[model samples]
Each structure stands twice: as C-alpha cells, then as structure tokens.
Target: MEYFSILCILSLSVVTFSETCPKLNVTEPLLFGDKNSNTSYDEDEIISFSCVEERRLVGEQYAVCINGEFYVSQVPDCQEKCVHAECAKRIDGYCNEGGECVCRPGYALFNGSCIDKKSVKTVISLATKWIPDYDHNSSNDFKVLQADICASFDDVFEIFNYTLRCYVSFKKSNQVTIANVINDFTAESIEGPSDVEKAINGAIQLGHTVPGMRYNVTEDTKANSTYLKECDENSDICDDHYGTCNDIGKGNYKCSCIHGTYQSENIKVDGTDCSVAPIKVGLTVGLGIVCGIAVACFIPAYLWFIISPAFGKAEYNTAAAAEVGSTEDEDEDDEEERDHKDDLKRDLEEDEELDKQLIFHQTMIQNMSNFNPMPRVNRDSQSYGVPNSIELSTANSMDNFNHQQSN
Candidate 1:
C-alpha cells in the first residue's frame, strides 16, 4: 500500500508537458507549425502553417522562434493580403503612395479592377463628306465626318447628348478636327461654311492633342429616291436647307469653276450695258476704219496727182527735157516714165488694202473696250462696297442713330 501510494504521488507529479508550452516562441531550436489547430514540432515532419494551409515547409517549416523582432520571412498575415473585399483597397497593386489600386503599365481597369489587360486600340478615318452652306453652319449637319465612337471617355458619353454630323461639300474642308467645344478651343461654329482646310490646318498648328476628338463611325448612306425632296426656289440649297442658288441671300448666289469647265455651271457673266447694242459698236468701229482709210488714200492720191503735176510741168517746161524730146529715144523714155507712174498708183491701192486687212486683225484685240473681260473680284465685294458718298440726310440719320436710341 505504502509503495503503491508513493508510485501514485510520483505519477501525479509527472503530468505531461503543458498545452501553453507550444504557444511560447523559441529559435535555434526545433520549429513548429500549427496546421490542424494543434501546435506541435517534430523532425522529418511535413507541416503547413495554419494561415497557409496548402503551403508546405520541408526542412524548417517555421522558426521555433520568430527570429528578430522584425518579420523577415513571410508574415503570418501574408495570407490575409488577398482577403481584402475591394481591389481598390489592395496594397499589392502598383498604386501611388496612397493606397489606391493602380493597374500596371499596358493595362486598364474594367470594373472595380486592377489587372493586366491589353491596351484598347482604335482606328480613326479622316475622309469626310458633308452638305455645304454659306449662310448656315455646316458643322451642325448630321453625318459629316467619321466620328470616333470610342474617343469619348465612358463617363463623358454617359453625361452628354452627343449628336455630330459631317457636312462636307465641294466648297470647304477642315483638314484636321478635334473636340472643339469640350475644351478651351475658342473657334466659333457659326452659320457659315467653316473653311475645312483652314480648320484642319489650325488644329494641326495648335499642337493640342491627347484627348483627341473622338469621331463617330462612318458608313455609306445612299440617297433615297422617293424620300428625296427637290430643291425649293425659296430655300437656296440642293435640298432647300441651304446651298446652290436658292440659298443665296435675296440677290446673292455662289459660283465655282469646276474641272473640265470654266465657271459655266450656274455662273452669271454680265456687262455694264445690256440695252446698249453690240451692233452699234461694230458699226462705229467699221465706219471709223473706212473713213480713216479713205482720208489716208485721198491725201496720197492728191499729192501724187496734183502736186506731182506741178513739179513735172516745172521740170519739163524748163527747156532741158523739151529740147531732147524731139528725138525717138526721148519719146520712148517719156513713155516709160508714164508707165512707171501708172504702176506706182496700182501698188498704192494694193498697199492700202493690205493696211486695211492688218487693221482688221487688230480690231479683235483693240477698239472693242465694251467686250473686254472684267477683272475678277470677289463677287460679294462688288455687291457690298459702300457708295463713296451718302446723301446728307442719310448721314445725319446714321449719326443720330449712333448718338441716340436706335429705335
């Protein structure tokens, strides 16, 4: 009984090592890992951390001691890194110093995302067609240039009512285009044909790009026959909104010279006097020419017949030629002289006729000031120039309007 009692006392005193013993940390000693919520250590024992259930440690699964105060190895919290509810709150992403989630280069977020994704690429086309008008703004026309459906940020597209059109025509072109109204660009879109070439060159000149003007998609839309409306005489356009002669303000119209044609299509050529007869000009010119020629021929003929006779009578009657004329040879010489005079008159008539023909050739170039080509001027300029002088009464009225109430 005494021996049995003593054995019981020893047994009771030798209770197994404590449960808290595993909780204490030590190093250079055997390491421990708690996988199934039980902390224990053993050599050759493949173990996993409680945090990383599937991750195995081969040689030293975990340090018996958590080494230095600082954590050099994988933190017990490494598993918690991915447990964040939102990617926005994640620290793994290459965010700014702020804890914002940022996608690395060559990537973009889709929705609540920080990921590596391919860059969204888009192709833009610049070829455009549009209705042209001088008085109404063409940029407002629908279906003008190829609009980039993707250029607008998603947020911006959701916010604005974006309806754009390309109104190109034979008259103008904007060489380059951009989001004009969205930024500080101050180019006015007025009720006039925007010089397309000028606008394109201007955008290129400004060198402002990045959030480029996103244009809409372009598709060939053919004209419908039955739905097509004929131009209205009152409207001044092909479809009557504005173009061609119908759109011209009251007395105005557009004119252009096309390839293979010179200003012939719907061009107006005018001279100062419509009622003044063209025949009158030709008649006056012809009559003047005839009179000038007649006077020219008559003076020469008078000098040859009247003046030469006086000289000849004085020379022959001086007795020198008269004394020799009695011989047969002298008579023959006199006859030859007479024949030469006759031939000279024939040559004069021929010369006069030739002069008339030469003058006629020049008539087409000169003498017809009425039919000259008018110097080209901006058609609008000729119609709009202010008269040099206004009536005294009109000037006074204008001065009063400038000073007093316009009404």
Candidate 2:
C-alpha cells in the first residue's frame, strides 16, 4: 500500500513538471538564443534574445520563462543600426561615413543626381540615301565612291535634321585601267548652301577620297519642305494656337504640335484647329457627363420656372422696350471711349509701319553714302604724263571752283 501511494505521488509530480511552453514568436531581426529548438522551456529558466548583425535590439534583451511559458516583452524589436540617408535614393551611389553622397568614376553630379556620361545615349536617324551622278565610262568606280560618300554624310549629318546629296563625276584617265578616278566632287547640306565644294574637300580630307582631278563646283542645297516663314506670319494659314507651321515645301505647311502635346485625327496640314488627343478625349467625356446630369436634373426646373415665366412676361416687356428703342440721354462717354480705343489701335498699327519704313530708309541712306563709282587707282605708284591743253584747262577750272567753294 505504501509503494502504490509513492507511485501515485511521483506520477502527479511528473505531470506537473512536464508543462509545454507557448511557441516562441519574435519579430523580424530579433532571434531567441536557442532558436533551433523552441517547443518548450522549463519553468524559472532564463531565455536570452539578441539582434542580428547590423541591427540593434530595443527593449528587454532577455525573456523570462514562467509557468513553463516564455513571456516575451512586446516592446522588444530589432531595428536596423544604420540610419537611412537622402543620398540613398541614387542606387548606384552610396552615402559615405560623413553622410555625403558619392558616385563612381566617369559619373557627374547634376541637380542631386549622378549620371554616367559614358552610358548616356542619344537617338538620331542614320539612314542615308545616296544619289550619284557619274560618267558612263566609270560606273563601277562611281558605285564605290557613292558608297564611301554616303557613309561620310551619315557620320557627319546623323546629329542634324538635314539631307545630303553628293554630285560626283568620274573620268577614265587610262583606257587600260577599268577603274575610273574622280574627276569632280561636291557635297552640300542645309546649314551650308554655298560651300558644297569646300564640304567635299573636307569629306575627302576625312579619308573618303577618289583619285582624280577636282572640278570647280557651285554650291547647292537639297530640296526640303518642312516649315515656311511665310506660313508663320499668316494666322489663318497656320495658327500658333493649333500648332506651328512646318514648311513641307512650295508654300505648303503641316501643323507640328508643341512639346509634350499631340494632335488628334481632326488635325490637318492646312487646318487651323489642332486638338490635343488626350485633352480632347477628357473634355468630351467630362462634357458628356455634365450634360447628362443637367438633362436629368435641370430640364424640368427650366421648363417650370424659366419657360413658363418667360411666356407670361414676354408680351408686356417686349412692346415697351421696342417703343423705347434708344435714348439721346444715354451716356456719350462710352461711345467716345470705344471710338478712342479704335483710334488708338489704328495709331499703333500706323506707328509700327512708320518705324519699319524709317529703318528701311536709314539702311538705304547708309548704303548710298558708302557708294563709290571711281576706279581704285594707286596715286603713290606713278602718275601719267601731263594731259593735253584741254585737260589742263579743265583741271584748272575744277580747282578754281573747289577753292571758291572753300572760301
């Protein structure tokens, strides 16, 4: 009986001692000291917690095991040790120990941004169209020259909105040789219209060359119709509000929208109205919504209060106002003011025209004053033999007239 009682007491003690602890739950970066096994903890045991690397622990660093459970302080947290800096916005750049932003080499700081100049790229059209005017005798040589010249132009003018045309002629120096050398060359673009020969020489100097005697050439510009100054002056033709006139050629123009704006299908080359596509769509939808609401809410009220009252008062006020017409007692000052405005507008226009005419007259007078009809003769070099009697007499009479005027 005593053995049975001892066994029962031991069983009760084992049951009381084997209490399982609550699961260990810790926020990010904070970890328990014995994280690998956390199923249970013994009563009255000390549980240690710590922060991971680059992190600082907040609140209590140790937890207590009470009643076979870990009582974790809610205030405990693992905060990052390093404070974030504004320079961190640049992903490729880093904040130094002194909190200053630094970028790698070959980069420059602009407006608080680090931009790699070597990695920057620009978009341009490098497509080339080559036109060759070659002699029939050296067709093969002309083809080679055409390819070389086209490549040169592509390299030079890829950055510009310009077209290039090369006029090259090849002549056979020797009948035995199949290859024909360059006889003449010329290249020109919009920027330099009258310097085609010079441009051709420059291109040849840049390693694109054909062996031949160079020819004297006149400068020529490629045909382009994109924008016209005349088109800009006429608002009816090309209004700036819709878009600016881009000269296409032969007094024709197309509307080019401003930066960050686009035109809808309603836009036309000659039309004055240009509607922004997104803005037009937004306005149309907004107007439709507003109209729908107005119809739903205001139509009945308009019919009852406005139309009904207008019908009742129309006859009485209409006849009285028509009979009254206009009165002489009405203020003449308003009319005078309107007339003054019209006069001022006319005067301003006249003044502008007068200013232009004055500038033109001054330019003409200055040009005329610089005119010299005499041939440039070097008086210091030599004098011809004395003139005959008639010339001497004329010189004496001219001298006497000049002396009299001075006196």
User: What are the per-residue Cα lDDT tens digits for candidate 2 across 110-188?
Assistant: 3234443211111111112222333431243343333333333333433333221112223333221111111111111
Q: Against the true structure, what is each candidate's TM-score?
A: 0.22, 0.18
What C-alpha lDDT does candidate 2 achieve relative to the native structure?
0.35
In candidate 1, stretches whose alpha carbon ends up further than 4 angstroms from where it belongs are 1-327, 334-339, 346-366, 374-407
Candidate 2 clash pair list: 225-247, 225-248, 225-249, 226-246, 226-247, 226-248, 227-246, 227-247
Question: Which candidate has the top score in TM-score?
Answer: 1
What is each predicted model's overall lDDT from 0 to 1?
0.29, 0.35
Which residue ranges in model 2 land beyond 4 Å of their true spot? 1-285, 296-298, 305-407
RMSD of each: 36.1, 41.3
